[model samples]
Target: MRTIALHTQTSEQIGLVLENNDVIEYVSTRPEVRTLSGSIYLGKVSHINKAIQAAFIDIGEERTGFLKKESVPWAQTSIEGTLKEGQSITVQVTKEPSGTKGAQLSADITVPGFFVIYQPYGKRTAVSKRVDAEQAEELKTWTSQQLGKDEGVIVRTAASKVSTQTILNEINQLRDLWTRHIKANTTDRSHKLFDDPILPDQLIRKHPLPLIKEIVVNNSKLGQWIKQRYPILAEKVKWVKSVSTYTGISINELQSKLIQPVVVTEQGMELVIERTEAMTVIDINSHKFKQKSLSSYQKLEMNKAAAAEVAKQIQLRNISGIIFVDFISMQEKKQEKDLQKYMSGLVRKDPVSTTILGITRLGLMEITRHRRFSNVSEELSAKQKPTFSKDTLIYRLERYLTENTQSEAVLVAISSDLYNHKKQLLSNSISSKIPQELFVRHDASIIDWQIELEGSLDMIQTVISERVYHVDNLF
Candidate 1:
């Protein structure tokens, strides 16, 4: 059985897709720059380069957005002298900001609905390839008859069973929203006019409702929101006070498993995955079950098993960009072809667009997946790494103390390694600046870059109560 469990923390929300009690997919959204992909922004042209035909747009963010000539909505013949510095333009983010570069923006805007994507600038109707050629032609003809000369619609696969009126209504709603955004963009400069829906709403719009057996939420407010947003799934909605009550595992346990660098398959094979800035590499290792004698058939079976497991891991971890999979060497050409076909079949289950490039001469399989947000490894590295500099640690400590000024006394505990590294601070007179009976202790139990606070029992209880609440009323 497949189930989706939701848990929200601070400004972040997490969703886990479980199949047969095992997590197959994970998603996390936070109020941070990493989650700003696909948003429509009204930007001011900062600079232009005629050599590359690209312009820098200031979208009211810390970094500017990059717009290329090919992504402009204007006619190719009429684009000359159309854009200039100090001009306001409406652009949508096609790729997220990476490294020091700004986001990739496009002038052509497309709004997605439940059954179709509304394109105000487009002139032709398009249908999804998932539908049969005959049915797609029929859909195209129907869309062409219904849409105006300035409007176009791309039929989604979800519209296969939907009524004509319903599809038209959805398209109309999307067109209205797009028009509003465009109008707002023209009036406001360097501001966001429209953004994608929240996580649950996005999931509902993408997946078929019948496939989601249950929608479980840890908070009553969130559960109510889902029920109100998707009335058709009201009967399947569930409210749990804690995520642990719904899923056998807690959020911490699931997160720990997701960060593991090595995964072992049921066939006694192991996969070690490494991620770098340029690409992700997966190495297949069979040393665990290796014996004195091994046949070609046995090796082929192990490789095939690894193929399926790799696909599942890729989806669960949300790894994107160029991926290189190093498989066990096979002597026969037919075996390599067979393995590639099997891997392709497995990757078809992923929702993201993934293209499997043929194997290389060195037996490394190449793949590319489109990415919209930071993957699990990137998030974990930012949140869990313990390498704070001494100055940063002191700044954080001072900030924490300043925030809790009402406390009568405060105790700061840190790992021994950090204490030893900063022992000179004791003589530098920085420790004496702390006021209100502050105590700094070195504890081996704590991590190097982490700071622990101890307050009254009453304060701890209040924090816990505020975190976990009863959602029984949601049902």
Candidate 2:
């Protein structure tokens, strides 16, 4: 059975996890403002670097969005002074901000709908490759007849099973939205004209609702919104408490284990995933599996199992960009070829575009995945070793208490030495937020920056120290 769990209890942002039977297949979270993709902006060109043939556009955000000259539809023509520093243009964010680099933008924007994607300036109509060849040709013919010469549409896989009226209805809605955006862009004020929905709504629009066996949302407000907005899915809507018992691993277990770098399989094979500034490296080790007396076939089977887990972890962690995987070496060329093919097929299932570069001379597999947003591991790593000031700590403590309304009083356990250092800051915040009762359970075993909160912190709390130690040793 297919199950989707919407986790909003962690913070204000929402997270979605797709599971098949009892195993996690996909995981994603709503991005913050700095990393927002698919947002349409009316931006002013800031600087043009002729050497690189790229321009930086000021989208009224913290960082400028980078627009390549080739990506600009008008830049291809012989129009002099077409893109000036002060010129305003409509662009969509194709990539999120990574490190110090800005967001990637494209002038050719396409608005995606449930059944089709409307390309305002596109030349020809097309169908999704997932559709069969016979139906795809028919869809192309139908699109040519139905659409105007100036219009273009890309029929989605969902359109193959949907009615013509449904496709037309979606096309009309998208056209109206585009028209409104164009009208708004003509005004003097520059702003964000459009943005894709949050994680939950995006999933609903991207996938057929009928295919999902159940939708469980942890936040009551989000669940109510889903029920009211899409009454057709109301029957499948369930509260967080009602569905907590269904997951193979409890939410807390998933959160705790997510921060770890190593995954041990049933046969004791280990897959170590490490993310660095330049690239991600995955190492497969069979030290424990070798203890058992097994033939070469059994070793290959273990390697295949490790390959599947690596693919799952890549998607689960949202690791993007260059990836190098070192698998257990096989002496036979036929076995090596089979392992390479198996790994390629597993990665093809990723939602983000991924390219497998095949096995290198050293037997390492190279891969490249389009970065969408900061992966779950990256997000957690950012907060793992943060240095907070007095005011920041107070603010965070207040925010945490306010967000978790279910907890009347929280027992905070921390190192005595660290507690003494921030005693004033903690007391001040506790006095304001927790008027009823405040308990401080100090233990020397707790390290600096380590915090333990008991009662109703299932989603917000993360065992950072435990995972950090494992990562430190692994690296």
Candidate 3:
């Protein structure tokens, strides 16, 4: 089953692509950490370093954006001579900010639509390589005819599946969008020109619509909006109160254990993954298998399963840069060659440019995935720790209390520390959204929040009154 599960709760939104019950790509986005990959900015050159031949740009973001010399398409001679400090420049974000680095800037701007990407700085037409050679040639000929002397349009893979007129219309639409929304902003002040971070649009840009069998979302508001906005996908959109309801998998568990060093696949194969500062390393082990000894074919199958799992994990964790994977040792060169070929083919499915550098003499499979954004470990590791702040506890408690809308009234017993924190914060904002007949019992000895009762208002109140009496009594 090919499914896109969207979990929107609290401040973060998570999107997971599941193929046959396995997660291949896991994307997490928050308002504060939103990606700027396709954003265009009207920036000013803050400073220029002659030694590094790079310029620091004020893109009206938290960090100073970095623009290298090569990224400046119109640059000539030296960086100091070509660009002046405080000069206004137009640039596109090629990569999102990772770690302490700012968004990667490029002078070459490209605006993408459903079927075509309009490039104003180009002169040649390009077709996606995934298209058949004959079809690609035809698309190239037809698309090139539509381009101007200085403009270009890349015929995306979706264009091959669509009509020539549809592609042309999209090209025009994208060009007009750029001209009106981005290019028209000729103000000298540093500001963002264009940024489209819609969740449905973001998913469509990453995964082809035809390949998506179903899209399950947790938020009812988002689910309804998607169906209303795009009636074409109304059938494919499924809304559930809980994200894990249809998948039979815990979204919270998947997220909590995502950064773990060990993972076990359904085939009884254990994968030990170590991510260091330099590279990520993975080892496949069959210690958990039931069979005491396996045949050569069985061993190969294990290795194959491991290879596929490694690819899935790589994308899910967003592991990038240098990677080394070690499968079970094989004696035959043919098996090794076959494994390499199979693994290479699997990695090709990744949206990011991931290359299989082939097997090393030490029996390590070498691969490199281009680093665009921070890995899941970098963002999730800290959050996964047991030590959560009082604010986090409040959020968790609130999520737990109101998860079941069927409950008419609910009462929860919470620790004094948590109750104090919630009271200290916006108490009205926190309490106004919950059930009308809700009661909170603050116990000094309690370390966790426990749901006391979920029933009619009279029943819940009686239960809380009894609890208060028992607490007051020494017995």
Candidate 4:
């Protein structure tokens, strides 16, 4: 069982509540700030790079916003010809800027709430994927009647069991908000027209229902806002004086736990997640329970348990991209099938799309999940510098050059901080390994390096073959 506590703060007061480790809620006295996630802006195109197929927009920021050609509303117009420099166009931000990448913008705009998603550009009504056929049809019909043909809306998963009155209230609120934004747009050209508010309902809309037991907020105003918008959830809401008091833990302790290494266990097996990456690799090892007396069937059961745990880990960590799971091999085909079945069931619970390919010939299971935001490891390592040393970079470069035999080669060193370090080592390492006969000049400003070997095509092929072989051996 899990308990939830809520904490809120006004200009003068703070409140908190604590349930179990599973649930805690808090609020702040800070004024509500707008997030760019779903806000629509009329931006002016500042620059366009046809080579990169990207454009920069002046969205009232120091750095111009970025909009890739694909992200533009292609259905609306032929963007290649329609978009021009200094032209004003309606756009929405999909992702905030991080690092050197500018904020990601889209011509398509969507305002998602707990019970419905409002699409300013859409003409047809759609239903959430979680809703059943009956509820979807009914909701679609009701939304059409209430909203008319002026705008489009997608009924959310939370509306699965909601009443018509609740749906109507949401529609009215959204319509009013949209109207206000439209009015503001006519008068304001250099400021935000409609930035999304950080409301409790907005948070609940973003997360999956099964994972969120409850929400707790400390501010009476926020608490009232939640209860007014989601009367059904009012009973589950708890208010407290402060977030720290609500969680029964200090802010520092909460941060530590959130940032700590995650440990997963199932049956007699355990796996520790020290770090995560675009390609998450899980190394599995048997823990205790060596079956000397038991049959092969008993051993197979442990492998199945491990597979199940891997699936759970993927969801809990919100891991995506190429995942390599090294599972304990079972000789029997039946055992492998059972493990696969168990893994499939776990994947079904995940909100993100997932595909579980069976074990590779190399005895590795490959799983892929769709990625939206950065994975758990990236979020945690935001402050830490990379650990790759100068020695390691040199060793990698030398191995690459020795194994691949080709006419010309390009080595792109991406990171700004590592460019100089990589360039110096690469030039010296290649000169030492292949002798001065190879021409190598280090250019610091060049983001990438191209190696061209002037010789017979066959000789070029030989160099590439050798370099590739050497690089593979180093890894």
- Per lDDT, the best of the predicted structures is 3
Question: Which digits, one per residue and each the tens of the lDDT, describe model 4 over residues 262-332?
Answer: 44564656565545445778867665665555466876777677766677556545578888877776677
Candidate 3 lDDT tens digits, 1-475:
4798888875777777888887777777777767788788999999999999999889999887888988775676888988999899888888777689988888777887767788887677898888999999999998888888878778788777767887787777778777887899878688999885636556646666577799898788878876654444679888887777777777678878886888898897899998777999999877766456776787778898899889988988999999999888777778888899999999888877799998888888999998755688777786443577788877887777557677777767778777777767644654557654566666767776777678887887677677563321100
TM-score of each: 0.73, 0.70, 0.71, 0.64
lDDT, residue 401, candidate 1:
62
> Candidate 2 or 4, higher TM-score?
2
Candidate 4: TM-score? 0.64
Off by over 4 Å in 4: 1-36, 47-55, 68-77, 80-87, 134-138, 181-188, 197-202, 207-213, 225-235, 242-268, 274-277, 290-297, 303-316, 351-355, 372-378, 381-475
What residue pairs are clashing in model 3?
none
* Candidate 2 vs candidate 4, lDDT winner: 2
RMSD to true structure for each model, in Å = 13.5, 14.9, 14.1, 13.3
Q: Which one wins on TM-score? A: 1
lDDT by residue (tens digit), candidate 2, 118-223: 8776657999888999999998888767776667788888788877877787777777778875535554455787776546666565455446678877678988
Superposed by TM-score, candidate 3 places the C-alpha of residue 91 at a distance from the truth, in angstroms, of: 1.1
> What local lDDT score does residue 218 receive in model 4, on the 0 to 100 scale?
71
**Model 3 worst lDDT run, 10 consecutive residues:** 466-475
C-alpha lDDT of candidate 1 relative to the true structure: 0.75
Question: Residues 1-475, candidate 1, lDDT per residue (tens digit)?
Answer: 5677887744778887787888887878877635566678889989987778888999988799999888886746423366888988888888778789999998877777767888777677899887789988988998888888877788988778778887777776677778764554466558888777547766556555456778788778877877764555678778888777678867677788778989989977889998877999999988876554666776677789999899999988989999999988788888888888988888876767788998998889999998744687678655544576776775676567656656554556666676665554444433345443455555667665343334664554454357542211100
Deviation (Å) of 432 in candidate 2 = 56
